[model samples]
Target chain A: MNEIKIFSPATVANVACGFDVLGFCLDSVGDHMVIRKVEKKGIHISHIEGFDLPYETELNVAGVSALAMYNTLDLDFGFEIEIYKKIKPGSGIGSSAASAVGSVFGMNELLGRPFNKTQLTAFAIQGEALASKCEHADNLAPALFGGFTLVKSISPLKILDLPSPDGLYATIIHPQIEIKTSESRAILPTEVPLNKAIEQWANLGSLVHALHTNDFELIGDALNDVIIEPYRSQLIPEFKLVKEAALQAGALGVGISGSGPSIFSLSQGLDTANTVKEAIASVYKNTEIVFEIHVSKINTQGVKILK
Target chain B: MNEIKIFSPATVANVACGFDVLGFCLDSVGDHMVIRKVEKKGIHISHIEGFDLPYETELNVAGVSALAMYNTLDLDFGFEIEIYKKIKPGSGIGSSAASAVGSVFGMNELLGRPFNKTQLTAFAIQGEALASKCEHADNLAPALFGGFTLVKSISPLKILDLPSPDGLYATIIHPQIEIKTSESRAILPTEVPLNKAIEQWANLGSLVHALHTNDFELIGDALNDVIIEPYRSQLIPEFKLVKEAALQAGALGVGISGSGPSIFSLSQGLDTANTVKEAIASVYKNTEIVFEIHVSKINTQGVKILK
Candidate 1:
């Protein structure tokens, strides 16, 4: 097929206790894109809708990622991208990651799947960098490989896909506030107490075990962030109230989604996820903050081809 | 059964990147203890062999642990423990843990098994604190729960049992130098760089995944210590040379076990573990410091009753 239409989903990165290393895909919200072969040589963002984004090839997240992949291959023809952006930018739920992954995923499909998931993630990270200001594969890996993805290392770019337990779901709340990735990152201390770091890694290690064994209680206990959240949570409105509300409503765990103006709660089932969504929204509604919430299952398939 | 004879195996704690939280049991060497019920109402350290350790019930490692557990119960009879210590004290391979585990395990057997593994670990930590100057379940958990254990939380004492992949073996080298756990701990920085902490948790998370999937190559790559080893390895004699030798001889990964003085290398199979033992021994042979080496399989069973 010369043309492909795909659904590139949003993701929750910096998963509690796993800042900059862990993430999972979302099935509840995403962006749709159509990529097709064009007669000319380079790259083009032919059409766009839903959100205002940079149209220039190098300037746009999708265009930049597609260009990165295109540069790797010596292709005769060019490709054109049509975007239907749905996930809001600066929502902290991997809006840029969706845009980035969509481009290369669609192109790789057109190219008869020349690149592997990790390579596609590398290309997607180039685009992701435009948004996050630093190279991180936490969001991109899950967006490409689906389920839970761990960025084992960054230099050589090692990505590990972890299990998504059955019935696991996520409830995300975007409070319609702006928190830049760089700004959020800036507030974090350059150094953390060694004891706190030990606690963080311990939780992260146990979280992986919880996932593999399908232990929801262990997941709840392990989803603690000792180092990053205490600092960054200050930027979000009513962060503590939202987390407490989510947990009180029976969410397995709750934390800031990424570099948030957004927060996410993970629950064992869709029912609890919906409950958690309503719970967090109730907390946000009391405040002056405008918020939107969505409950989605952990997307096991990552970026998918639309019917 | 009024009397129980047991072999409480050694363990490698602070497993590489898993400082203060992770550990695995070993089968090569350990300590044997015979604990019997006495008509007296207090813990008694009746016999001591091999090591010139204190026989006072309160000061002894095994006795302290037995007292901790004994205090939790309202029992009439007390315990008498006879220790035949084989794993050298200050070897950094859970010598204290084995002794700590042995008393409680044998007593629990005589008392018809009252405590769970986590509870057992908690009591053992009391004894372990006497050695490390801190309460750590890293070594104790593995000895009680078997295989690998992650001390997810220290206060509430949460231990998550991790898998032992088939054919996994350990080669431990005790360089016959003294590095007390408290002194080794004192050398580490109170704080760590945020980036280094992130790298640590990333490796630990991946290491957990590797254990579950039985991915040996991933195990090799993920068995890295970014935070603790750099500081503690300085205290060990020829630490760099030993690690290089282990890796050069096909060991999966090498690091200072628990604290320093003893270095451990993990390999994929029995043959590689043996080879790693030889290589590290060769490196130590050139040094003025004396050394001893032992190669053992991953002990899936923590404390075993002598058949």
Candidate 2:
């Protein structure tokens, strides 16, 4: 296939207890990208919709990712990319990851599927690094491979796609306020207390176990972020009240998605998910900030070719 | 039904990547306790073997654990306990946990199985606290519940028993050196760098996922302990050499068991386990320190009534 269109799902990184290592894909919000083989041997961004992202090959995430794949494969052919962004940038829901993953994934298919998921993720990570200044696969891994993904090591690039429990729903509320990922990251403590670190690992281990065993209650109990959320949550307006409301409305656990402004909660059913959404909305009803709420089951199909 | 004899298996706390939170039970090396009903309204230690343990009800781990159970139940009858210790104290395995768990577990059975595993773990933690000055269930949880266990929280105690993959072998080498648990713990940094902590959680999250999915290679890659091993491994003699040798000889991963002096390696089969045992022994062959090696599968039945 000389031309291909791919859709990559939004991802929730950090996943409450698992900071910098855990992430899962969402079904509803994502980015769409189309890549077509060009006669010229250079990458180009032809068009961008919904957001004013960089169109230069080196500046655009999708363009850079496709370029990385092109260079990695030593392809003589060039590709032009067209991006339609549905997931808002700075939404803390892996908007950048969608573009990065979609580009490499689409390019891989255009290049006759020359790269595996891990190799594709490597190129995607290079693209993502342009935005974050550091390479992290927590968001991109899930967006590329689907389900819950754990970035075990970045140097060796170990990514594990974890089992997503049945009946799990993600309730995401994008507060429409942009929180710079860098600023949100800057608020985190450079050094965490040893006791708190222990608690954090315990919670992370328990959360993984819950996913493996499909224990919803254990997942709820383990969805605690003592280290990051305690500091970062202060930046988001009404974070505590919304979280409290979500819990009262039967959310298993709730926390800031990726970096904040967007809060995600895990629930077992649609009813509880809708309830959590309404509860979060009620907190922002009086506020002037426009919010977008999306309730979705986990995106088991991560990045896929649309054409 | 007036008297019962129980055996609680030794446990490997910390489990490499999961510091202060993860542990697994072993088939061999444990403490045995025999408890009998008496007319007196107090707990007593009638006999001790293999070590010079305190005979007082409040000072001894077995005594304190029995007392905790007795107080929790407000039983009308007293009990006398006889201890036979097989796991050497200060060996870095769960020697103290064996006593604490065996005592409470035996008492519970004597009292017609009044407390469940979690409740029994609670009593056991209280008993262990008498020795450690703090309550931690990393050792006690696995000792009480068997297999791999994660203590998610201590306040509202949440423990998860992970599934043990078939054919998994544990090769433990206990060098005849003593490292005080308190001193070992005291040497750890009061705070950890956020980057290292992030790597640690990633390894831990990956390890749990590996266990759930039975991914041996992933488990091998993720069995890294950057936070504790770098600091505590210094307390154990020939730690680096032994670990390297074990890894070269086909061990999945190797690290100091619990606090130190005992180093454990995970292998997929008995052949590799025996090879790892020889590799560890070859490292310490010229040294003056005596060492004991035991290779066994995971103990599924943690504490059992031996009748």
Candidate 3:
């Protein structure tokens, strides 16, 4: 392992109705890390490109994941990592997930890829726990494997691969606003209403079915979130207006991405995809939260080593 | 238009965790109905065969469904009908569904097949209301379209086709004891614990994924009913012993069939299936009820018209 160049993708956590249990990978919006083996027994970091992200080992999410992977495995080799943070921090997308997944995925290659994708997810989750306290595998699985994925059983962390529906396009609008993950989660009640939870599950079951059979209409109908979204939507300014506009513009379904101010809508074609973006942007008159519109397919590959 | 012969198969409702939303058709065990235009203005019912079924039109489920279909559509066709009941009444396996589907389906042919499958399901549900009070489509959809099916957004009754999983076999043991459907339903609470419902939904989501991907192991893992089964199992005399024995015999999961006096266990293969059947039978040493075992595949077709 002389010079290792690894790429880790961005992830979307708290995926709509799935909350802690479901998510898929996004290929275009992600971060990359290039790590080179060094002679020293300690780690070194550099910010090569993209955003001027934190490079301190303790401050950086990628650095934390990389350090944890090395320490937990008892590896003696030190690494110098260069991160290209394409995903903006606090975007409600798993911005840190790219760092966490990229670091652990890159570190595994440096250690001769001892851990498989599922095992690597655990390492990435360890780093995520540092920030969220709860270890979520929803974002990590998609960040690792891409496509539509379900964390069916979590005790042993059983990962079920879901089919990526054909002719499906995701239109994400990142409204440049600051809503911390903690604050968004804080608005949600510790305990949810019983009837609301059942409806959530029913919708979830239908969603899983729609993904499996690639039924776009069914997928649209099943993307409802009753448990967290109702309470959490209040934290995001213009959430309802944005959602209505996006849907009226031909988005099949729209909801908060992860725990957000960032919102995403599912569309069948690029035309509707573009319409969804413009519709969301029209509502944000107060702040220039730098809304980025992404129209892409489900990324079926999680973490990849570039070189 | 001439002599019309159509088959609507029997279905399994409340499929473990799916309760109201999930059901599938059984190919072998169902009602057989045949309808021919008699050139009259009234439906003349005759030739009722198989099982212990009544010849009276008012008491017959199939006759009721046919009457509803004829009245709702205002079809002016006099029909001669033959009914053969295979799925026994009070067996917990959607017995009334077989008759209800058969009646509407057979009459539709007699009326020149005016309705589509979903439309037919709507008419059949009207017949089911006579028996169950509430309108449920889970049994009717699968009974019409063979294979695993989902009744989603059930108020409007949206039917979805689910993939039939591989390596799945059912070991069903019917203890010849009488338990009325109304009596069984009376024992269940109108409401359930919130957490238990979530667990049920989680299992249901996993079950849908399992069917989509043909994951038999996961199907077994997901065949749990946290709410209805626990309370209803008390009604079945040998529920625990049969379940324990079936699991011991390598069956993946076991639960009450429909409203039970009947117990069914799901297994991976023929060897395990036979063992499961024998295990359930052994527990009824002193009981007067004779146990019958069925080792069968999931019936895709709901009802049939055997000449």
Q: For model 1, what is the alpha-carbon lDDT of residue B258?
A: 82
Candidate 1 regions with alpha-carbon error over 4 angstroms: none
Question: What is candidate 3's lDDT per residue for A2-80, written digit by digit as tens?
Answer: 7777667666665666766778777677777788788777567865577776668877767777777777665566888
RMSD per candidate (Å) reads: 1.2, 1.8, 3.1
lDDT of 1: 0.91
lDDT of 1 by residue, B212-295 (tens): 999999999999999889899999878999999999999989988888688999998899998898888888788799888889
Model 3: which docking level applies? acceptable
Model 3 interface RMSD, one decimal: 2.9
Error of 3 at A49 (Å): 7.8
Give the range where candidate 3 chain A is weakest over 10 consecutive residues by summed lDDT. A190-199
Clash count, one per candidate: 0, 0, 18
- Which of candidates 1 and 3 is the stronger one according to lDDT? 1
lDDT of each: 0.91, 0.88, 0.76
Over the stretch A64-96, how does candidate 2's per-residue lDDT look in tens digits?
777787876565778888899999888889988
Error of model 1, residue A297, in angstroms: 1.0
Higher-scoring candidate on TM-score, 2 or 3: 2
